[model samples]
Target: MPLWCHASPAAAGAAHSEPALPLAGGNARVSPEVSAEQDEEGEGDGRRWSSLVPELLADILRRVDADAEKWPKRRDVAVCACVCRRWREVTIALVRPPLHCGRVTLLSSLKQPGPRDAPLQCFIKRNKKKSTFHLYLSLTQALIDEGKFLLAAHRNKCGFHMEYIISIRGDLSHGSHVGKIKSNFTRTKFTICDLQPQYEGSKVPSSSCRPRLASKQIKPLASTGNVETGKVSYEYNLLKSRGPRRIRCSIRCPIEEDTEIDPRKAKKPSTPGSLVLYNKLPQWHEHLQCWCLNFHGRVMVASVKNFQLIAPAGAGGPWGIQDDDAVILQFGKIEDDVFTMDYRQPLSAFQAFAICLSSFGSKLVCE
Candidate 1:
């Protein structure tokens, strides 16, 4: 278990522990770089692979693994290169594809000017036992914070674009912690029905998706006119290869105003309907107001630990909607990164599926 088992690296750092001493392996003699700067700038001898034999290369890879003492020998293919001259050449060939890890270097994206480790991410970096590991550098916001994305500011833009940055940083104080971490993806799944048409209707056209739309009252956010809508639904693949024995998921959707979603002619809603069938508006306007809270990091104050949507949506929309119609779900505790939840809606006698979204991935605990 990496140091994140209970206490933070900063917490561990405060304990006044001595730094680690290098213990290189094999008979190839420790690379002069070992003493140069742990992993900083080292005097590397760029030797050729043909000069070394295959068995020698394997042992060199092992030596690199042994030297790191913090990297996971199993998952990381990059560390093999550090083992010896030939193995380094071979490892380069394997990891070159995504040789680029950490952070979405897009100017439109911005990250909190601090460590961007997810709990799971934190868990992974701290577990690996190898040296010469990958870091979330080379992709920092400083790399891409220069481009202008007009589409990001528009709600009805033709193109679907969002600017987000995912960078990784190691707890240098603990070598084990750095090995436990890895790179991350750029986009995340988010859909707040009645929030943004683009969001509700923005579908990536994935076949692997298990069709989790609320079939009873709503169709999939994809088929309706919502195509290219800002609405987005992310279905994550919670894998064991990722870090942390458990992950804490948080979502915050804030509705700033009393909005209405008057589908011109929505079918019967979950709420008991007393809408006027003949003279009254055929489509009922469901007024709902919600608060959204976005959390960024750990919780240090008294606050909510989880949020559950009440009677979330099933089958909805693409119905006859009026101008005054809208829906809002506001988020709470945003600056804290806790991502707490808060919402309040009217007691109108209408019908619609309650929203169903959670931090847990769609495939989390399938029934």
Candidate 2:
């Protein structure tokens, strides 16, 4: 029952790429119908669209949320949601503890633990840069819905605090692509890290080009960070591919620690770092999916989650991945039903990976 669910699923896909009202760096939510007329000299439509602040503001929030994983410069989605009165009311309410009945979005049947029954907040969305922690909603929660309609609360703890990046490479190095990730990621450690390049048009070398199905499904990993984050981590590298290449690095990390790729030090749009690792992990030819490992070096992602990785065509770059061959996670049983919680494995599932780039993870990089 989407705005146009009757239409083909492809139609929804079209909406995603439909020149979303041509918004720029700023989050300006102009109603689609009115946005086109914003530049016209005063008179009717221009003023009318300008007057419809609520509609425009909503659209702006929608767009900002869509790109939250990419151009991340803020903490609160409310920053985008509160551009207008209507959004402010909605966002503020969602953040309150013991969420009200109707403000939730994706939690269809999740049962929030009562203060007495609720588990102690084992996880917190502590935005290090923001100097705070958001223990309420999650990116998935926000993506599920922003409107205040459903009311049930679930017991979804904040998962890991990392993104699993799958990459493809074209640079013929001395070692083969298959290797242990421990040595590569001396400092950082996650389920999957950028190890190669992605393709744009064609698959690279032996790799295929298959964009991941739902990169957004990647869960966050839990973290009790150690003492090694201060080391000099090498910057992500970008390379131009001779042919098409694809890479799918999907891992679960945490939302608490905002450790993503910075575009300022990145190479090209194609040379995206931690940012692109979001839903756009990558997909490729046919239906081949990449892989990851657990702490004990056992493959995971398949036994637990419902996600896979793919590579886009023409995805290659100059720099090598920081943790190309990192270990995949070993997630225990997580009741799909958030209402009923379990505690077999890591309480909070955060995605991580080991790359050959720099020293990450702890505060004082011993290496």
Candidate 3:
């Protein structure tokens, strides 16, 4: 069953109606009711509410923010933002990016760097028959069954090249797509492109704002233009060695300068940097006659797709990694159709998911 079907009607409605979170120069959409009320009430009522002491509003919002830290509950933070401009500002100010809090409270969190201390846990469900993939945020500490739906991607074959259109909607319609992953003729290399520009001040033309749910007023920010954010390439094994498959990634995204300091106080680099990730070499288990990489018991199956991504020495820039011992991103098979994907700083859920998608299908030349 689809994860969205598990969501409550109200939750599903909100998911379909709410505008994309403000990220990469996109603006938040004001709810129709709020806009209508404001127009009817005029600035007088707005000023009256805006007159509420800033300190008092902040105090109340801080309590609300602290109380609702996880999703379902985390929707409260976004709700607070939709109330008014003042509340929106306060909500955004109080909420920490996924890099700091390790929580994805808003849609924008999907684009921001992940947690530094720990890799954000997630799972991918593949519908082989349809050539579709769905990424979900594990709601529990351990991977079980249920999760919050994050992004969906469907594979499309165009002559020699293959493309994966990723969207917020499960249907994978063109209107809701945020980005895409395109591969070369041999499928040895793939380029990931964000539909929205990375830099601020860039404008998405009105024509690009196509709503999937036109009647419901759904306008996702992902409808913007394409911007190359990362690339993934597999190392060829001409000899077809018995070793595990090897892959490398180069991602362009913001890097956290200091995770030790308070996230609100820490300074972040304005420009995105190139983050490099290489698969950790697996050891040969002579008795089992197979190569293995420890997944801490999260992964039960051994397959070529199983990999642990780590930063090369000095490739960690602002990530603060002194050595390559830490696993930045790890994906392994947990079941026939299910897989575990865990990623940390310098990699967003979108980027992490795209990398895993590249592991799918057959790489004849690379193998």
Which one wins on TM-score? 3
Across 294-364, the per-residue lDDT of candidate 3 in tens digits comes to 89987978788899999988888576666678898899998899999999888889899999999998888
Q: Please say which candidate is ahead in TM-score: 2 or 3.
A: 3
TM-score of 2: 0.19
Cα lDDT computed for each candidate against the true fold: 0.24, 0.25, 0.75
* TM-scores, all models, native as reference: 0.24, 0.19, 0.79
Ranking by lDDT: 3, 2, 1
In model 2, where is the ten-residue run with the lowest total lDDT?
A: 338-347
User: What lDDT tens digits, residue by residue, belong to model 2 across residues 29-113?
Assistant: 4443444454354333324323446555555555544443311222334242323344434333333222222112222111221
Q: Which residue ranges in model 3 land beyond 4 Å of their true spot?
A: 1-51, 197-223, 256-269
* Worst ten in a row by lDDT for model 3: 23-32
How well is each residue in 29-121 modelled by candidate 1, as lDDT tens digits? 323223335234422223322334666555554554434322232122332333344553544332211002211111111110111121111
Q: Positional deviation of 167 in candidate 1, in angstroms?
A: 6.1
On lDDT, the leading prediction is: 3
